[model samples]
Target: MTKNKAVFIDRDGVINEVLTKRVKFVNKPNDLFYLDKVPEAIGLLSSADYLIFVVTNQGGVGLGYMTEEQLEKIHKKMKIDLESEGGEIQDIASCIHKPNEGCSCRKPEAGMILKLAEQYKIDIDKSYMIGDRDVDIEAGRKAGCSTIFIGKEDNTVDANFSFPTLYAAANWLKSTSNL
Candidate 1:
């Protein structure tokens, strides 16, 4: 069977706003605030036949800021909200370990992406990882996928491309011949 192509997206700061000062993590459903046009971006990517997966690092669970059940509830709400907006999420892979836990599934590590690629029969070479941090870009590179940084142009992170938002990235991907 032919392998599928995918787009791995980071949850916080990419799909949802990360209130750095007010709230460190989205521990509850009410804390979850989506970034502008995120669902539309996901829908656009889906239209391009790119399976979308949210790969997030939710260390707050390990830190006791929230429980696994609460995380589930938040994800459920997120899924419903996106689906209602014509966007689709194939799955969500999260690393619940603490920052120094040294887990393999966290951002900057290829474990999550690799496992998902295997599970979904995905072709990493044709896949892309869109995120807002250096770790996310590093993870995608380690996983053998193109990386798209969703933030201001920063030389610190070596992303293949940088965009202001997911929607902008989606548009570029749709028009790019490289993909």
Candidate 2:
């Protein structure tokens, strides 16, 4: 059976604004503002028939910064907003483990993406992972998916592609996937 192509996205910096690298959690639903052109980019991806999945490391739930219920609410709001803009995300998978805990679902680990790939029968090679951090790139590579780093030159993690923003990367993904 043929598998579907997909795009795995990071939550903090790719989908929503990253207030600061030091503090990486949307504690309140009110804090979940997105970067410019995010919804438009997502809509483009969706229209191009790429299954979109949000893979995030929301350690705040385990660290007591926020509750699981609060995270759910935040995600609910995100989905509603995205749909309002004509974008649809197939699923959302988050790792609630702390950074110190050697959890497989966290960034830098491909567990979440791998599991979702299996469940959704996704073609890892045909899929793209879009993220802003080094760990995000690492995870995508480890999962055998193309990685797009949404930042300037970063030596720690080498990505298959690098763009300054998710919108730019999404445009590239759309054009490249057609080839």
lDDT of 1 by residue, 1-179 (tens): 98999999999999998876655669999888888898888888888788989999999999999999999999999988876657689999999999989999998998999999999999998899999999999999999999999988888989998999999999887776244
**What RMSD, rounded to one decimal, does every model reach?**
1.6, 2.0
lDDT on C-alpha atoms for all candidate structures: 0.90, 0.88
Worst 10-residue lDDT window, candidate 1: 170-179
Q: Model 2 over residues 1-179: C-alpha lDDT tens digits? A: 87999999999988887676534558878888888888888888887889999999999898999999999999989988876667789999999997779988998999999999999999998998988898898899999999988977777768888888888888888887778
Q: List candidate 2 stretches off by more than 4 Å.
A: 20-24
User: Model 1: residues >4 Å from true position, as ranges?
Assistant: 20-24, 177-179
Residue 152 displacement (Å), model 2: 2.7
CA lDDT, candidate 2, residue 5 = 98
